[model samples]
Target: MARDRARLGGRRAAGLFAAGTAVALALATGGSLSQAGAATQSDAAAQTAVQAPKATHSQIQLLAINDFHGNLEPATGSGGKINDIPAGGAAYLATHLKELRAAAKAKGQDSVTVAAGDLIGASPLLSAAFHDEPTVEALSGMGLEAASVGNHEFDEGWHELLRMQTGGCLPDGDGQNNQNSCPDPKHPFEGAKYKYLSANVFFTNTQKTLFAPYTIKTFKDGKKVAFIGMTLENTPNIVTKSGVEGLTFKNEVATANALVPELKKKGVKSIVVLLHEGGFPADPKAYNSCPGISGPIVDINAGLDPEIDAIISGHTHQAYNCSLPDKAGKPRLVTSASSFGRLVTEVRLSIDNATGDVDRTNTLAQNQIVTQDVVQDPKTAKLIAKYKALVAPIEGKVIGHISTPSVVRTNDDSLESPLGNLIADAQLADPSVVSAGKAPVAAFMNPGGIRADLASNAGAVTFGQAFTVQPFNNFLVSMDMTGAQIKALLEQQFSGVNGPEAAKYKVLQVAGITYTWNPAAAAGSKVVAGSIKIGGQPLVDGTSYRIVTNNFLSDGGDGFPAFTTATNKVFGGLDIDAFANYLSAHDPYTPVATDRITLGS
Candidate 1:
């Protein structure tokens, strides 16, 4: 619960001194004391002994980070800064965590480092290039004990995620199964030393959780704190459908509630939830302030059992230290560290040894920036350097040129972004002519697949920059769909069953197509009737047209079912390769206008 990081120094010292004085006076008067006086003194001494303060509490430190997304090197542009202070590199993050752990030890506090989730997926090229093996090694080197699994962890599917946990490289299959082995072919991919927790995800056939639901951490004083970890329950809706095919994600609140009694039975009363879901605060400038925090986490926190002392969260990637009340109306600490290792949320919990419960009045949390002022950890730096050397050849090769230092990922009000338009156009231009028989009429790109914005130096865009923008390695796909399905696909962007992230209002970025929509209309019917067209031709509902998209969308990633319904599927080149080819063909490319999809309120 929300409380100051109070010290018991003065008051505890004073009580001990008074007790000592009382004992000395009784000893001095014992010889001259009568028998009845002596008996009375003995009774009083016994009472004093019973009333003396014992070490009935212990303070624990929880160091946490989330949504790292594997930037082994310091992030670039705005991603690397907090208030203009450069922040976040695997090396810097390691140093900060080590310093925090050391400081806690100096204060006689035991510390454990953990992460909320999204630790690996959606990573930049350095880590993503080697299946994020380097990131795992770096975090493991920094002493991360445990972390919750985030939705992005499923980006490469469950088995690959398992490989990240359990050591070893993906077996050599068709190049699709294994991108690369370890960062260095000389050494094997040693998996994460820390454990990953997932309470809610269950296999449909077995109905068993994918990972341990919770783990009990024992401190030096025998005080135990139970940590329950879970990703957002809507994970299935946002991740690719195939990655989580046999898996069913359960309700977050229910998952934790069910585990409370079990933990209590095991004599553990102090509880913390490492949740992979987070909230957005109204104050955009304050990293530690939680003014008007709202999201799925709000409801989840409110529903949690009072036994849970705090929740370290992620996924929304906003930083905040909040005091939220549980179902019992007791203030509980809620926190999140912004993504890409930029910050770490430090939480202190004072637990009562006598009751094995957390002392709610002494719970404290704050987000500490991983500033670049400190010396980087040598071990982490070496790990980064090793990977850098391995990737340098391809990493620095120039793929194309941008007319301006550019980015295409931001959306003001309409969903289409300059980057999205560019990517979609690239896919449309480089269709599967050999397999699909001819070029597709149009292409759609999912916003989630666009990981980073390309910013060129001296107008040159390297493979590393393009790879960072579209690193998923998804294959472009071509298919045939009726005009009715095309219109349905456009309507799917409005929200409802097809929209997993309804709050974000996901809109498809398109090329070779145009549509107008009324925001005031109902969700499923928002796209204006008969307004959808390709190449300025009126659409007949029964007529078929060639459509192109990435494998992820064609398989219904991000809830686009219309894409999955397309007929005569033909897969093409890697999405990144297609984008690179398009850029190469049109060197010195200028940012395209994002005016394809119009919206009217």
Candidate 2:
């Protein structure tokens, strides 16, 4: 029934535009009266007087934000700055949106706000403890129209997302039910007013889309626009496989292009794609404006059909505002607003009345930073305040104590850090983990997942603090790999050598085994052959060895391709649980660098 209504509406809109095209052309031509010498005064007068009957042009403005990750408050101090400009917080974002909307209104334009996904999940204690209900309410208040389903959205699986989408108010941990649990009590999920587009995600059993493939929105001026949303096709690899067990993500480019003909049949010529994947700036340190750089975005953009007028992307978390040529050499406007509500990408488009197409002649695209100079929206501010108060009792409730400071860093500076060693030790102790098979051997953790540093000051570490360090809830998996695979994995870590972002590719802290290597060795052959071992026993080249690590590396994240071909793979163990259990079993334990690895002497 909705399809029938939309199709009818699209046809009517197309007919209206066709009738008005002549008048629009006349009005456009009349503005150049000063150039009458080039065309005869009579011709100019005729063009000005005979305006097409339905001649009217529509200007549409699209505003996008991505990776909110449920941060309701401003991220101040360190770790949140862009070009020295402080950014983020819903209140600040609201202020920016209001100004952008007013500017569009002043220019007689229609506007819609959308997101590229990851609006929730891995949230702060304020929202996560409350089941992310407050975050949903905040988004509703922000008036988010449409969003692509980011990987984090599935953290709690599809059932939870559906509840967040259609239900009203989430329950607080307190036995008492509170109406204020969600800010907008009247319409808690109202902000999800716009449909969630999932062009590529489909259910395996039914072979059908769980959500709408795309959405066709009609403007007051009889202009119809279509938006298609998709995340990176590799979502299954990043997310818990069980969470999406019954679904499959198709090829992004193939899914988007397949929908184009259907949209065109519905008389929608102005098309926009909201892909949840973004490109990394070629230079790792280059925070802004890296042009013609190559990464995931390069392949995805080049593969996109010319019919796609604009592409709003996120995931890589880098920001870029530039035009990359499509297969046909026609410039495709691609923009990524930095993550955590730091920026908003705005695309201004003009529609052609003749063929219902965007006026590719003049399209403007740019990313505007959401600076702290703007005031926070009072309503959003209050919502954050309410949640903070609700979680206050448990926010600082220390669950355990540490004897010494555990330094946490992501680069080579993290070698044998106390905190990393502690985490690696915990993974090895968990009997449920494959790495723990028969007394276990060693455990490895990616540095990217550890988000905080354990302060050496004599303070208790709370559940909240531990969660912040390991937010993804990744499960600990154990597998058996030949000694050759271990060496290959280490070498893969340095594959980015001589590349712009080489520093990022370096491995950090390791547990259970220590090895020394020469950075001067060949990229693929860097790991010293004899230096590898487990528990002081030399790794047998032909023998299979049990290894413990998270699912991220097991599936080849962070360029660890060697693990993908492991012969014996096991699963269903939560790494966070292992860490928590280990902490519980060994309170007051202090980590020390116990010869896990040694630098080449």
Candidate 3:
């Protein structure tokens, strides 16, 4: 670290040069990646670094973060802390990356910065208001080379995702979701300086992909390392339909395995997969421990070719380090950095000069907390100040207060969560829908839709804070469903039913209803008989009741197909609007009881 500081100024100058080149081109073409320019500034920076003297140690350092969710400023409340330590924010993240890069450089070790995905979408008001342009620019300014395209990347639809990758200003000027895009007409919204690789996401009926499937980086010594990036295969099911209309996602392992021979043909053996899917750590509090860790990544890793050297994952947003066995039964590194920029996974690779392959025995990984202990990166801080100033008036508005310190989605349990209950209740009480035709007697909110928690701001929350919790901008939807159909929706939350519960059991957060379910029972029969009640009255199979939910659910997102069978559909205002109104109206809202969801028979 000490040795690299002397030359930090030089690298900064080189980075500035690259940024200038990109900005000039963006301005020339109104923020589009011109046909003549095949690479981004990040790629230029990487290529420039390889011109340095060859490293004595054959080690390559990989610094990774995932699920950043556009947090340009330090988070507050429960989401801001990791194990009781103040963490996250783009400035601190940049500081950490520079420090790690500098330290590695001092050791003559080549290093690259990367992310798993969810770098944008479901962001705070500051970033989302600008269509996440600030996030793309911030990561680019700090030097992110590549990342997998997570489900959130498709939240706005195919064209938007492409625009995010290529670069362009949103045509509509301001007041988008109560925020402006391209705030300064003088400076257009340039896209990512980093590459977004999607090996599994492909164009329907075509061999091409939305973006390049993989990328290989060559170092000073002529040693090459290949990175294949991909999101989970079930991305279409989780994201809105329009976003993935003309695309198809292939199996992760198969897609990666098929690419191995091509990479080998190019003499690249040091392979790494940037996967946007992860597992839950048995000990969630301990960032480094991975004992009994289990999830979709485990199976995905096992199916990968043994030639693949390492795996960096995200999506579940929990951190852990483990040496999971590959196809050959030899242990290899698999890691994840918890979400919201709280942790960063550092993976060190020692390659064999003889075969240009990574030696599994020498591979080591660790998750570093992005503590507020370091000096915040000046460039990132300055950039954040720009957005913060513009977002001040709206973001600072006081919404309401809650008695509890937090109403968070941190605990994704089967029964219920305080945050989920609050959202469902808010949707059920939305005046926009209530005053239209018939009022919904019950409201359901998908746990996955709640991004952040309602942090208590000294018992007075701000709109900025509330915006982070539900940023999707999905409108409220009310429809009529038979009691029997409602029962089917409840059953779908478990496996062997019409859902993805085999991997993740999604218990719907409810309002104005109560029911019990047995986890041990067969999936189709998980819902306890005679337990469901609406308005303190026993549910009858033939009875009809109105239910309110988000538009995504009404479209049958997240495996609840029964939502699609409903009738008498009525749309209301945005979910965020309803939440803000509910908070303001309730003033000192107390968290609802968890009694609505019973654990067992």
Candidate 4:
């Protein structure tokens, strides 16, 4: 009995309570207890407090995914594959999650499905056509209980994002409207059933979070787990300024640490952080393995409170399962499932039900592939079909034709892609855009903004394909910048402001300009001196020239801070509209020559 009590850990309190009840019953039956009995009872209570169990354990499974980006249909190209097998799509993702949950159930473990974030924004044409209602419905159907709000979640502005969470039709003619609520106008759109936690984001006026900071889930035996979700503090640096105008993002570790005491006060101890920031792995090929993982998550995890048991991360779009040390030098699980529903991270946490704390020594985490081998979930398929039918008419409309299946995002050298060049030219050539922002001398496009290559398999391109290439719906912004600022912008492509990503070379595609750079030069001086020219004239450092770029870059996205310093900014028409108009105006479009950016040494 003593050995059994010792194994019960903190549960000894319950046994003490039962013993007290037995003593009361005996005294009631026999009229009164002896002095010796009272002394024995006191001793027993003392022993119970001293023998509080530290060995009892219960396991809970956290099924996590991140950066879903609303791919209703299966993703294609390299995005869809995990090694040799095709993976990802709402249907396959749902089926895999169901199977994983069932498998956990078979082992008598409690399970919950969660996501780190980027679940809705940057969606495909099918889901984006209806304001991502189908994606929200599909996630709800899959039993997704909670997720963090990603940077893209603020793409359509926080107001529309709030509408996405609250459920309602878009206000007509309010300038905030993009797509309708649902296919059947009578049905209207139902918002997410899951919770969105943002412990970091706060309203500038209210100083309070827009959503719940965290949520606690209690299992059958009173084992509780708290999930704290938030995006990276640098959300404003990546997303548009207007979208995050009235908000401020707090540091990840600071916000998480602040919440720990409050959660402890609420009697919740086991904690998992669903962070929207992630790191790039050393090996791009390892989807479920973390070999030399390094990024913002590394430092954030190192500084986190010891109470934070595990962190499910995303946003870098790389899959990695790693165990890193926390502030106390204890190993903590850090996991991210690559974007587009390609993988699911299965984190099994052993919790002490008696103490409501995680058993750090026994925690295990792994990333599982969401392969196409699984059958599609019927509910998810029907949801996708409904949205597909609604979008088919708009999606199938032929916008224009391509001559040689050109306009690719990457060139032979992989720096200045043909598609990026075409997109930059399109923005530069739009008449309506020119009228809105005045005829710009030059335009540039960020490579990250270009989502897909212009692949014309049948020499005919549709609106769907064009929309796929530039899905952000960013408007062109014409601005004035000094040639010195332009030089600084070019220099940023290689080093300094861009941080580690600079080494990967995020070359900006240009229109109406040519420049040469030395790859072997020191950081910040990689751009060759006096090599920048426009229309065969060398760029004058003191000259103020009109420059055009998408709103994302105009606001200094992707580490290009010089764009934010631009003057006389004027917003033009949407980039997709500009690209479509340019395509129609220039039919049988062949790939542009890749002589724009030159590399010396």
Candidate 5:
């Protein structure tokens, strides 16, 4: 027989209370009556005589957020559906959490708020400029219980992450004393309050783990809930190789499953898996009434154990709420709140007395947008204001001007827009970058790094607008690659399950190079014959060429392993500073598409 799926609507709420009442009544009446009489009672009388079961415990509510990336202040959108709502800010998120906690309390429920990694790293100038310590402090104020480690968490290396976890104390870029935790310091990071979870990440040399594998929290109702945190297990492949050289990321499913018996032995029947990986459907742009039905969530949900009552996911930065059946055909709640603190996911679990397990029959999950429509939390607002003041000089300085509006949308294929091209060109032109013997003969920028669009009003481009375009302080790195290696790098850009469609991972924003590719051409032969060139010269297959890109790409982000094959790599300082200097040196600039890339007409 097909097991009944849990209904996730208002009816489910009614069913929960009704079921509790029915069970209570059955237990009450059966205890009061003689065994023979109780068995002989008419069905109608038995129903009436039975009393509702008084809930021995309250419901468990877990509130989760992910991929905040240290966006302390709210950001204005450049384009896309997200622009429809006001961008997320830490203050607004705090207000939303307060309201949710109050609402849950009104119903006699216990609630806890947590996160699924990328909470820091790839941050804006407000936080990144200060080594992301401000973001750590802000999250601490927001009461983040714990977060699964994401790839960006190791952007500056594991030791840096540890500093952010404890009070921030690290050497300056010059290897001098710049400990924010120093007494009477100019910039102190003495206020961090959250814990990081690392179930699978471990050190290679000492075999010592970075953080605790899992954390157990006991609720007011005496129910102990165990949360196991793990990333995609491919952390090393996506992050800079040096950042994770001493760590090993184990399998997510296997890691979480192994913890089950340990948690059970500790008498914790309710388990929640907070994995930092996510799912994406074949078409991310398609609007579906039921959003979570399609992506990686579907496969991960199906593979999870029945004993696991819920899974909180992240990394895709998409919002979804859905329930999938586990091995026992019991509904297991799986959810992911949108990125940048734009939304929060709520999971409600009801425990069954008979089995000492979560009654999957009554699990409820939903995601709510964090909007400015709600009142702001004063403390969170103050922290944002403080950081804004600290970074004001840098954030407000005029950088350059744009004559047209530039847009950045991931689902679209136009990665090399006028604005992205200009930024890449600026990095390649920096004197510090050019001084290197193999100055960037070509450059590539990841579309994902371009956060916003530049709005042109036939006038000056303000510093705020420029920073928004390329916020992360990624350094420019130059490397030497042969023509064949470049072709291999471009092949990673296709998107789909079978062919080039499965290669969406390879899209590049090019500078100083123009090329045409044919989709109809063979996979290995996608670059049309004699189409690629550097500086108007056809790229020689045997000759080496200089390439410029952010450290992330040089180290192979988005599955482009071919980049790591480059020789004579040189780190040319901060890419953002390079861009700023380039803009200052060449103000009043007008950028146009040079037709660097063209899909065969």
Candidate 6:
């Protein structure tokens, strides 16, 4: 993953992951990688690799992906499928991209591969173990020209995000961190090859943008295309607070509109926005339909200047292609490829040579699956192989087994999922949380915190699979909250107090408690009165009880502000460690519905 074997986001600067392991073979095979500093080539060099159009007015192809999440290997289970077809793998993705570009080239079309955001973070062991360098290298190899910054990009904090943008070694390199910067003394981690554009993100102290606000790509026909990329304005509410400490995210519409005049001055008429926020659509398949589509994007798109040609979006991980109206009431092209590298949105635009503007009437967009049927890109496969071999010992160790069919994230009618219950119980039973006479009787886990279903190889769960389930390295925290505060916490799950996630449910997976909620009730009064119970007893408003949950939740992540008022907070170790150790202790664990909550009509 390093141009010389870089680590993923530089989890730590310590420990050598077998020096030169990624570089020797990768360089020999001509894998895509660039040292963060001087070794990184110029933009002109990268653009020169593409075939330019010989004819005037040739259509430009925009191949885009979003929320890749560093699934370098072919994802498995439902996560790997789109419309029931197996899809997603960096190798397969590279192959499909090459084929698509080739087809475009044959038609005299110039193509550029780009992404909306979330190319990394919440990754599998293959990319994460090396600090996501593999992912940056893979995407750069596949010709990713530009991308927006997603909330996950700041998971390790803005400083680390800066490290990813520019090349550097992690401060903790070589000896300490769980993930080494892959400790390559020679080739040092190379930053991303593509430009990370953030029109909305700014450092509070400097008031300057974190990265370039926009980048222009010129074509052979003397036409220039301007790309303005940005994450959603509400990034702070979803991600851990400390990660975005000195940064401020401006409104999506305002930021893009403000740049319109600046871009027009540069004679850049064709503008495309790569946004990290998206919406849910009526069609589940989301290949071509956009029936009844609604979300923040609809309104944001409607407010965007008509000068912006198209919108490529990610996050929410839903696939859809829609032509919604822009500010001038003209239909505009907007698309999203589902997460985990499963789909690529191919947008073809007819450029007007005279005006240097996009021909809206001729705009075409489609979501192509990164199907496994195609031959995998060999270079990328070797890159995957290089990292896989390095982390084999740790990733392959069987931590436990699934006694039941599978512990899944799928929620029942009550919104309680098997895997969620398991995670909550794991947190509650964690030795650190429960040790030394700690009396935490309840533990809660946010559904968003559980990234994936617990996967097992032939029923044997490994450390790699465990990492996938809880990829975020958040710590466990036990805090004291009186029953009144706990009840207030439950009430905050609905609208009127939980901020703008009004239509969605933010239910917490629980252990050591049971409660009921009435959906038909008013927003702030949804939780049924007197239904809350802790340790099989009725709620006691005056009594204080210790509850355990991830630090994200305790810090009021996902809008549960009641946690912020909690007292006597105690920090446990990494959440992933607790999950893996729990699996070991509860080996051959059968998953059963805990039936912790009930829903009232």
lDDT of each: 0.77, 0.67, 0.79, 0.78, 0.67, 0.78
**lDDT for position 567 in model 1:** 88
lDDT of 4 by residue, 529-576 (tens): 888997679999999888889888887887899998998888777788
| Overall local distance difference test of candidate 3 | 0.79
* TM-scores for the candidates: 0.87, 0.78, 0.84, 0.87, 0.83, 0.87
Candidate 6 deviant stretches above 4 angstroms = 1-56, 171-178, 183-186, 434-437, 496-503
* Structure candidate 3, residue pairs in collision: none
> Which one wins by TM-score: 3 or 6?
6
Worst 10 residues of 2 by lDDT: 1-10
User: What tens digits encode model 3's per-residue C-alpha lDDT throughout 496-565?
Assistant: 4344435568888899999988877887898999999999998999999989998778877888888889
- Residue pairs with backbone atoms closer than 3 Å in model 4 (clashes): 9-52, 9-53, 9-54, 10-53, 407-419, 408-419
**Candidates' RMSD to native:** 12.4, 10.3, 12.1, 14.2, 10.0, 11.8
Misplaced by over 4 Å in model 2 are: 1-56, 76-78, 168-191, 282-289, 400-406, 413-418, 429-438, 455-460, 477-509, 517-525, 541-547, 551-595, 598-601
Query: Model 3, 9: alpha-carbon shift in Å?
Result: 35
Q: On residues 21-72, what C-alpha lDDT tens digit does candidate 1 reach at each position?
A: 2222333444321232233234444534533223776768889999998878
Better of 3 and 5 by lDDT: 3
Task: Write candidate 2's Cα lDDT for 391-470 as tens digits.
Answer: 66555656566775544542343255667777888888888864333545778887766756654336566655666666
Candidate 1 Cα outliers beyond 4 Å, as residue runs: 1-56, 171-179, 433-436, 497-501
